[model samples]
Each structure stands twice: as structure tokens, then as C-alpha cells.
Target: MTDPTARPADPIRPTDAEARTLARDLIAHARFAALAVLDPDSGAPMVTRIALVPGPDGVPLTLISTLSAHTSALAADPRCSLLIGEPGEKGDPLTHPRLTLQARAEPADKTALKAHYLSLYPKATLYYDFGDFGLYRFAPLAAHLNGGFGKAYRLTPADLAQ
Candidate 1:
């Protein structure tokens, strides 16, 4: 018999084909995500909304400003997390599907990504070439997907590979 006070280590379900499909779809179509990083100075968690795009092989990419707090934090510590997917027009927001990805931020070559990024976000061209702006890639480490109420799965980086 188990101790009454004991709790499960993780309530997440084992990954399945359905879960994989949902996770891939979310990552593949995500245009923007909530970026979470540790504040370099205060060590507090900071989250900011950012526009991101999927690159070759579904890797997440973002053009960020060096002056931004999030960028500074990422420079100090590459580990970060991202939340993708949005709630539908109807129903409680909590009842919708969402994905949280764990990743490491790494600097990406601006020249290689500029043209493609511009094609997707034309207006960004105004600032894409700014001296302080740079491109970065989020290397997936792991991901947690909440498909809906009672639906949760833990995914390895390989599960997200395109």
C-alpha cells in the first residue's frame, strides 16, 4: 500500500502518436510565443511576448534587439522556455491546447535568415537591418503539451524534430 501523503511524481501521460501530431502542429505553425528567461541582474523570471518564426526543419527563430532586457538575459544564460499556441475564440482559455517548450538560446547568422524572415514579416524590414537587431534560434530541449483538460504529455527534443 502507498503512503496516503505521497503524491505522483508527474501526472503527465506517456507520449503517443496523437500527442506527437499535436505538438508538431503547434510548433510548425507558431508565429509568436511567450519567451521566458531569467533576469540577468535580479535573477527573477521575466516573460515577454515576441514574434517568432519556424525556420528550416521547424526550428524556432526570432530577431531580437540587443538592448531588450530579454536579449541581455539570454546572453548571460542561454537556457530559456517558450509557450506556444493560443486559446480559441470560445470556451474557457484553460480548456484549450497549449505547448511549453524548453530550449537553449543561440545566436544565429543574420545573413542566412534575413531573406526568409523578411518574406514572412515584410514590415519587419524597417528594423530588421538595425544595428542593434540580431537573429537568434531556440534549440529545443524538451516540451510539455497540454492538449486540453486532462490531456498532458512530456516530449523529448527528438519528438519535436521535423
Candidate 2:
């Protein structure tokens, strides 16, 4: 027999229904997220805000400039992290759910991914002319979703894997 105090095993391996719900919330509620990449010089962490476009695969993609600090970092080290949460309001922001996705940034083939990103964020077309603007895909390796009040879940890429 199992101990009564022991928590039940997770039915989901990488992510559960709750985790998916949280992921959807993060994609819908947050428009911009801070992308953190490793700096080449000191190997430190560098962060920048980027316009996020969620893909059907549940990964977030963005267009970044080669000149941007975060993009520079990505060029040096493809490993990166993304933080998405409710912008601080008058009330306790902790009450809202937040998600942090650990990912790998890769230069994506500009065929389908570009069209998908642009379809999701038509407004970005205005800045498409920038030479530095290039298609980058952030493939999530893992994620931590916190739904406040000690409710949190961990998700892995396998969760969203097709």
C-alpha cells in the first residue's frame, strides 16, 4: 500500500492540462517577453525585450536585430531564457500567473516560420525593412509556470512535442 501522505505521481510526463492552460495564458496575456542570453565577453547574462509571437508548436519566436545585445549574445551562445508575466499593476502582481521558458535560440529558415510569425503579428511588418531584423526561433527546452499561491508546474519540450 502507498503512504497516505505521499503525493500521487503526475499523470503527465512533461506537461499536464494545468500546465497547458498556463502556457496558453502566458501566450495570450503577454505580448512582450524578456529574452536572456549568454554574453560572449564575460559569459554573463544579457536580457532584452522582444515582441513575441507564439507558434502552433507552443514555442515563442521573435525577430531580432543583429545589433541588439540579446541577439549578440545569442550569436555567441544559442542558449537562452524567456520570462513572461503580467505587467505590474496596482495590486499584488504575484496573484497573477507567470512563466519562464528555458530555450535554445536558432536562426530559423525564413520560409514557413517567417510567414507564421508575420501572420500572428502583422504590425511587425512596419519594421520588416530593418536590415538587422532576422527570423529567430526559440525552441523551449523547459518551462516553469507559476499560478500564484504556491501553485506551480514544470514543463519540458516533450510536453509540446508532436
lDDT of 2 by residue, 56-111 (tens): 66667788887778887888889999998874566678877788989999887555
Error of model 1, residue 29, in angstroms? 1.4
- Candidate number with greatest TM-score: 1
User: All candidates' lDDT scores?
Assistant: 0.91, 0.77
lDDT of 1 by residue, 94-122 (tens): 88889999999999999888998888777
Q: What is the lDDT of residue 140 in candidate 1?
A: 95
- Name every residue pair that clashes in candidate 1: none
**What's model 2's TM-score?**
0.81
- lDDT: which candidate is best? 1
